[model samples]
Target: MQIQDLPYSDPGVPDARSGPHLLWWLWRNQLGGQLRSLAWGLLHFVSVSALPFCVGLAIQAVVEESGTDLALTGALMLLCGIGIAVGDTFLHRAAVTNWITAAARVQQLLARKAAHLGSALTRRVAAGEVVAVSTGDVEKIGWFVEALSRFTAAAVTVVVACVGLLVYQPALGVVVAVGLPVVALAALPLLPRATRRADLQREKAGRATELASDTVAGLRVLRGIGGEDLFLDRYRRASQEVRHAAVRSARMWSLISAIQVLLPGLLLIAVVWHGIHLARHGRITVGELVTVYSAVMILSYPLRHFEEIAMAYSFSRPSAKRAARVLSLERPTDAGGSREAGVPRGDLYDPATGLLAAEGLLTAVVCGDPDAAGRLAERLGGHPAEPGVSVLLGGVPLDDLPLDSARTAVLVQDKDPVLLSGTLRELLDVPASGAVSAEDALAAAQCEDVLEALVQGSLEAADPMDARITERGRSLSGGQRQRLALARSLVTDPGVLVLDEPTSAVDSHTEARIADGLRRLRTGRTTVVFTSSPLLLDRADRVALVHEGEVLAVGVHRELVATDPRYRAVVTRETEEDPAPAGADRNLTGQGALLGASDKLAEIEESA
Candidate 1:
């Protein structure tokens, strides 16, 4: 495959069995690229191998004072040089194509698996592992694929050179052939130890990576609880462990490298000594001795491939295994006999919570615990809470529909939505229903200030829409990020939008305007907002009060505050130290844990 065709149109289904098998599968799939690389490598090695013989001919010609023979030998040498240049260039091109195409295929496969498994994939796999697999493991796998073909060509060159030596002079060929294999095979004995050390280093690095992500994710909470020093010390220790493990791995590899050099040097010494002795005794000509010695020197370059291919396989085997493990993960789907595809619009009904979000109405869910509200929001979007319990849309379980279909019908804007780095236009360009425009969504979400801030921060931006947001919207404040994410959801304009604490980060004035805009924009569509902020709840068409995972009361926000003390306590966030009036200002208590990632740190640790 060409470099431009790096990512295959389809990466195809992976073997997903064992790691070695996965690597083999990749090899079989990219055989064409391998063949091309091998062909070029053969041309390069064979042409280069002819140089020693040409040099021997020139030496004989000069010694005999045959100018004609010397000139012909010089011409042959020039042709060999040209062959070397062309063959090496194309060989490198083909080999790199193989490597890059292989890496791209693996990355595409991982991305596809992530899309299919969604949040469940994160729950089952470590974030650090995913990050590692996509970056480091991918390079290792590709290197192995590229190395295999080059190694094959090198092996062929060695065998061909040895055969030529035997045909020309059997005595020297026998001595050289015997020593060559010994040199190439010398590094095998130490590889297992080296591989073990490398594996230990990877484990340490992954631990440090996971620790770093967790610390950064909860840095706000860590500082709030005055635990920065504790985490700092913990990370420092993890960093040290990684450093020590890397040093050990390097030492083992260095020893292996030393063996590669030592064995080759010993063989070269033996070949030169034997060749000089033969020339002295008149058993071989001086020119023949020169050819034999030069051939042995040339063989050293290819011999390194043997040691390198071995090391590549050792490192990549484990990486392939990890990739296979992730690809094999299948999210549990009910496949509840195909639901109606035509039923795009429907009310979402959860039997477990007795929460009936009627069609074409703005329903609000108020939960006493922020965690419970987050879980309920996930459940509504077909996330598994308890197996076999599902929320239904228009009498059909959300799980019954295809995963993509369910996702389209009921879009759940979790408490902490992500704002990907891009221009505002690209962020809003989603797989939407096309009913809502970006402008309308931005207005509804009260993101005018966000647009102005983005424009001010970006120097290259010609318009607010042209401004670039940083990764995960780190350049924006919490409120700005939240508003931008909400506007993105609005652009998609899903059938039944379930928002968990959508307006929790904004002030009461912005919240009121957002509430008004939301009600106006989504006049005839179903919307569910899970929040404790009274500003949002009061504007809801109806409110369902959830207590201890069940809907305890269903009424207007005013009536619930008048009759139910539990609803009042949760919604008002009332406390003995700081009790507030009903209309007092407070943002929605958004307890989003890095898209529900922070809430299950223990779960992530256990799974890892």
Candidate 2:
């Protein structure tokens, strides 16, 4: 099936079955051409089963009477051997095709699930769990899928061989039939314990993976604070724990492997002893006894596949459960299926908190805790607001409207927004509508150097704005990335733009330019800036100093700083020697000079 045709929605819940149900589910999807491979596999298996029976028939024919028939029997045996060789070739080819196709389908499902869950997929499941499922889990699932048809044909061949033996000589057939089952069922009792151990191993591995990924991501910060050794010690301990878990899993599997070997060997011994006793009793000839022994020896190979299939399922079950959990995360809404022309009107209301940002106004939310401000911003833009926060746009509940409509009307620009890799121009081409021009956005962001660098690097050759950017825009400085993210948000031109620390990274001069540019760019739209920066706060039409999750004071930046000491400290980093200046009156011209004072003070203290 085409990827587009595959259901992106959740499949409700998965069934925990070990047999044909899962095999059929895989067959029906035909994702990655599984059905075609499945057909070829059946043909391969059928031809394989013909080899043993043909050999037995040749033996029976040669034993039956004349030297005249010997040549014909030898010719027939040669043809059968050639057929088996050809069948084995086709079987290996078809089996590999089945294996790859099954792996590919599971991979596609995993990718689709990741897309559906979006951000929540990582939040709900550890990064390591995702990695494990994609790599190890996919292979185990594929192994089980390909093993099923071979297992089926092997099982049928065994049964038919036993029946043929019964017709040839009932005494040998009885022993063969009963002994094979004992070998197959011996591993069943240990499955539960083996599965539990495997599950523990997988869990430990995921935890270790998560720790390793997180440590790498924060390696720079850890080194800066001299905490690298501490984290390394912790990781070493985690690695030992994973090692211990794996040892336990290996011990259990080793025991299962022993059973697989021991039981099959005992069954072969039992069949040989019974065939000899029957020969002594004059019920079977020497040639018939040799044929019986050969058939029992061949049975051991297929019997091992049974044990392997069990092991594969034990490993894959937890992985499937993890994949299912990831798929279960709720998707972002766009559910209603309607598009709006122009933009939304009036103030956006968050009913849950009874907060309102009036129409065509500059609203500022000041929360001492940065997280609270972030939650408020998400609520304002119809994001996953907390239980009590319900955002409304134009007197309509934001949640009630279709997801696309709410998102288009309100845009939330977080402090540390992600910058995708691409040319400076391509990075800003968000929402893919070309609503904001490259020159205009760069001017508004005061990023003249960034644009110039992009051009000089030949990024602008194909399309002045279309340079190739690396993943996460790691090539750019932190401040540049931040500004580029802000510029991209500004270009979207939403009716309501909520920015959390939009100017935190840029210099005072650039911050001031951006603040003024923002006021001009969003002249008629309802804009809310969440920050404590004096430059951004001073530019706001009004500022609300939020204390203890409530609005304590609301006014211009100057009014709040003059009257409220807490607001003054928050915006200007005031101290006893020199109180912070009030609002826009604060001197921001010497952008680098302000930070230099703090640096000098630290240096003097170090000398002392």
Q: How high is each candidate's TM-score? A: 0.83, 0.81
Put down candidate 1 lDDT per residue, 465-506, tens digits, no spaces.
999988788778889999999899888888899999998888
Q: What would the per-residue lDDT of candidate 2 be over residues 520-600, giving only the tens digit for each residue?
A: 777777899998776677667888877656677778876776677777666666654566543443334232244344345
* Candidate maximizing TM-score: 1
Candidate 2 yields a Cα-based lDDT of 0.70
Please report, as a residue range, the 10-residue window in candidate 2 with the lowest summed lDDT.
584-593
Off by over 4 Å in 1: 56-79, 210-240, 276-282, 334-343, 351-354, 385-390, 400-403, 451-468, 545-608
The per-residue C-alpha lDDT of model 1 at residue 110 equals 98
In model 1, pairs of residues that clash are none
